[model samples]
Target: MISRLPGLSLPERVWNTARRWAVAWWRILYLGAVVLVLVLSPSSYGKGTRRALARHLYLDTAPVLLGFTVLAALISLVLTRIVVVTALSYGLSRYALEMVIRVLVLELIPLTAALFVAMRCTIPNGAQLSRLRQAGRFDALRSQGSDPVRIELLPRVIAGVFACVTLAALSCVVALVLAYLGVYGFNMAGLSGYTRMFGQVFSPSVTMVFVLKTLFFSLAVALIPMAAGLYDSGERAQPDSELGGLARMFAVLLLIETASLMGNYY
Candidate 1:
C-alpha cells in the first residue's frame, strides 16, 4: 500500500529521504548539545534536582551493575579460557592475552554495555516520554512556567549516561581480571608481565579511542531515544514507536564501534 509522489523521479525521492535523515540527525545532535549544556550549568542543580538526579542514577545503575558484572565475568572467563587453551595448544600463548584485551575489554564489553543500558533504561524512558508528550504532559508543564526538559528529561539523560559508562567500565574491569586469571591462574608471579602486556596493548591512541568510544556510546544511548520521543508526532505513539529509535541507536553504536576498530588497528 505504499506509493510515491506522482511527479518525483527516483533520484529526487532518494535525495529527499537522505535530507530527512540528515535533518533528524541534526535535531538529535542539537538536543543532545542542549542537554549537555544544561548538565554543565550550576543552576540546574538545586537540592531537589540533585536528589532527583541521585535517585534516578541509583535506579538506573545499582540494580543492573551487579548483574551485568556477573554476566560479563562469566562470558569473559569462557572466552579467555578458550583463547588461552587454543593458544597453548598451538604454542602461541603469548598472543592470547593481547587478543583477549583487544576483543573483550576494548570492544565487546563497551558495545554490550551500551546496548544493555539502552534496553534497560533509555528505550523505556523514551517510550514513557513519548506517552507523556502524546498526553500533553510536557505542554501542561510548560504552561505552568516549568521547563520540562530540565526538571524531567535531564535526570533521565544523566542516569542513562552514567549507567552506560559505569556498566562498561565495571564490566571491562571484570573482563580484564578474568583474562589475567584465565591466562595465569591464581598466581601473583605473572603480575609484572601482565602489566607490561596491558601497557603495550593500551597505547595512547588506542586508549583514547577506547575512552572516546565508550563516552560516545553512553551519549548516544542517553540522547537518541529521548530525541525520538521529544519530537514524536502523536500518531505513532504505539508500542512500536520506540523500535525505530532503538534501531537508530544500534546503528549509531555500530558506527562508533567500527570507527574505534579502525582507529585501533588501522
Candidate 2:
C-alpha cells in the first residue's frame, strides 16, 4: 500500500519492518525460553537420559568438530601472522594481540561455531522432526505416555548447545595459542605483554558481554532448529518443509552476531 507513495512510504515501510522484526524475534525468544526451561528440568533427563545424551552429544560429536578446530587454527595462524607482521611494520605491535583476540576469540570463533552447529546439526534435526511429526510419531509417543519434547527435542537442543560451546571454546583456545606463537615466535618475552593486553581488553564488562554473547549464540544454535521443527506440530496442519525454520534460524544467527558486534564496539 505504502509503496505507491514512494518517498512518504519509505519511512513508514522501514518503521513497519522494524516493528515486525522486533515482534518476531521477541516471540522467538519467548519460545526459546520455554524450551530451555523444559530442557533444564530434572524430569527432562530420565534416569540415564542425561548421561546417554552427554556421551552422544560430546564424545561422539567432538572429534567430528575437531576438524573445524584445525581449520580455525590455520586461519587464525594466518590472521595472527598478518596482524603481527603488519603491526610490527607500522610500529603498532602493541595493539596487535588485542586486535587478534577481539577479532578471533571474542567475535569470529563463536559465530563460526554457532553457524556450524546450525548447518550441521540443527537444520537437519528440525527437518527430521518435522517429518516425524508429519508421520504421526509425535502423536503415538504422546498417546503412549511418552513426552516427545523431553525425549526427542530436548536432547537435540541440549546437544546443539553443547556442540556450539565446545566448538567455540576449542577454536578460541587454538586461536589464542596461535596468536601467541605468531607474536612471540615460541619465546616467553611477550608473555607479560600478552597478559597485560588481554587484561586491558577483557575488562569486567567486556568479559560479561563475551560470556552473554556466547550464551546467546549457543541458545540460538539450539533453539532455532527445534522451534522451526515444531512450527507445524499440530496434526491438523498440512506437511511443510522445515526449510522455513532453517532460514529463520540463519537470519536470527546473523542478527545475533550483528547485535554482538554493535554491543562490543559501539
Candidate 3:
C-alpha cells in the first residue's frame, strides 16, 4: 500500500519543475548560439576578418590536437590491455583486435573524447561568461573600446571546435594502433585487411562528412554550455542551471552523431 504513494515528495516536485525550466532555457540558448555562429561564419565574406578567424582557428586547434594525442595514447594503452587480457582469458585472442577497433576506435573513443572536453572545458567557458556578466565586464569592455563577442567569445568558440577535432583525430589514430597490436600480435599479415577496412570505413566523402560533423559537434558543445551560462540573471546562479548546460551539451552531441550516422548509412 505504501508503494502506491507518489514517487517524489514536495521538495522533489519543486526541484523537478526548476530543472525543466532550466532545460528549456538551455535549448533556447543553444538555438540562439547556433544561429549566431551561422551568421558570423566566414562564408559571409570579409577578407581581413576571414584571415583573422583562420589564424585563430589554427592557433587554437594545434595545441589542443597535441594534448589530445597524448591523452588518447594513454587511453589506448588501457583499452589494449583490457582487450588482450580478456581475449587470452576467453581463448579468442584472434577476434579481440577486430572487436576493439570496431567498438573503441570507430565509435567510443571519439565520442568519449568529445564528451570529455564538453564537460571539462565547455562548461567552464559558460561559467566564465556568467562571471563576466555578473561583474559588468561586458559593459566595461564595450566602454574601453572592445567588441566582447569577437574578442572573448569567438576565440573560445574557435578553441572548443579545434579541441574537438584534434582530440577526435588523435583518439582515432591511437585506437587503430591499439587494435592492430591487440589483434595481430605484431605480425605484418593483418596489414592488408586493416588497410582495406580503414579505406572502406573512411571513404573520401565519408571523411569529409565526418570532419564537418565533428566541427558542428564542437560548435554546439561550446555554444550550448556558454549559452546556458548566460541565462544567469544577476542573482545566485541556480544549481539546476549548470546541470541544464551539461544535459544540453549531451543532447547536442547525440543529435550531431545521429545526423552523421544517418547521412553516412542512410
Candidate 4:
C-alpha cells in the first residue's frame, strides 16, 4: 500500500530521465553547432544561404551597431582627451594611439559588442521559445505539418550568428579608427606597424577561425536557451520557467565561450 501510493513506475522514471537528458543534449548540441559552423565555413563564403544570413545579420545588427558606435565614440573621445592631456603633461603624446587601438579596438570592443547582443537579443529569444512551448504552439505547428527545427529555430539561429559576426566586424573597425585618431592625430606614420599588428592578430586562418567562432557563439546563444525553453511541459510553464531559461542560457553561453577560447589558445 505504501509503495503503491503514487510512485512513478519504471517507465515513467525512464521517461523523466530521458527528458532530463534531452534538455542536457542541447548543451552538447551547442558545441556541435560550433563545430558545424567551422566545417561549413568554406561554403558560407558566397552561397545563397550565407548571403541570406548576411542580410539578416546586417538588418538585425544595424541598430545595435549604431548604438555601440555611439557609445564607443563617446568613450573613445573621453579617453583620448584624457590621454592627450596626460601626454602633454609628460611629453609622451605619441603613444596614445597605439594604446587606444591595442586596448580598446582590438580587445575590448568586439568582446563588449558580443556580450551586449547576447544579453539583449539571445535572452529574449529564449524566453519567447519557452512561452511558445508552454502554449503548445510548437506542438500545434508540428501538427499543422511545420518543422519547428527548420522553420522556427533555424532562422533565429542564423540571425543570431549573423548579428554577432557583423557587430564584431563593425565594432572592430570603429575601434581601429578611434584608436588611430587618439594616438596619431590623423597621421599615417604608424600605419605600417598598425598593419603589421593587424596582420599578426588577424592572419587569414585566424580571421577565418574568429568568424567561425562568432557564428558558433551566436548559434549556441540562440539554440540553447530555446532548447531549455522547451523543458516547461504541461503545468510547469510558469513565469519561473523564464528565469530557468535565462539561467540555462547564461550557463550555455559561458560554456561555449570557454570552449572556444580554449580551442583557440590551447
By lDDT rank, best first, the candidates go 1, 2, 3, 4
By TM-score: ranked, best first: 1, 2, 3, 4
Q: How many clashes would you count in candidate 3? A: 0
The residue pairs that clash in candidate 1, if any, are none
Evaluated with lDDT, which candidate comes out highest?
Answer: 1
lDDT per residue as tens, model 2, 1-266: 22223454678777754554455456568777777688668787786567757765974257658788888999899999888889999999888889999998988889888888777887777777777877898999899998777767777777888888888888888898889988788889989988888888888877887888888888887887777676552323322236545666777778877877787788
Q: Write the per-residue lDDT of candidate 1 for residues 139-213, one digit (tens) a residue.
A: 998999878888778999999999999999989988988888888889998999999999999999999999999
Point to the candidate with the largest TM-score. Answer: 1
TM-score of 4: 0.66
Q: Per model, how many backbone clashes are there?
A: 0, 0, 0, 1
Angstrom error of the Cα, residue 147, model 2: value is 1.3
Per-prediction TM-score to the true structure, in the order listed: 0.91, 0.83, 0.68, 0.66
Listed per candidate, the RMSD to the true structure in angstroms reads 2.8, 5.2, 6.0, 7.1
TM-score of 1: 0.91
In model 1, the worst 10-residue window by lDDT is 232-241
Off by over 4 Å in 2: 1-27, 233-241
- What local lDDT score does residue 238 receive in model 2, on the 0 to 100 scale? 24
Residue 126 accuracy (lDDT) in model 4: 62
**Candidate 2 vs candidate 3, lDDT winner:** 2
For candidate 4, list the clashing residue pairs, or say none.
97-183
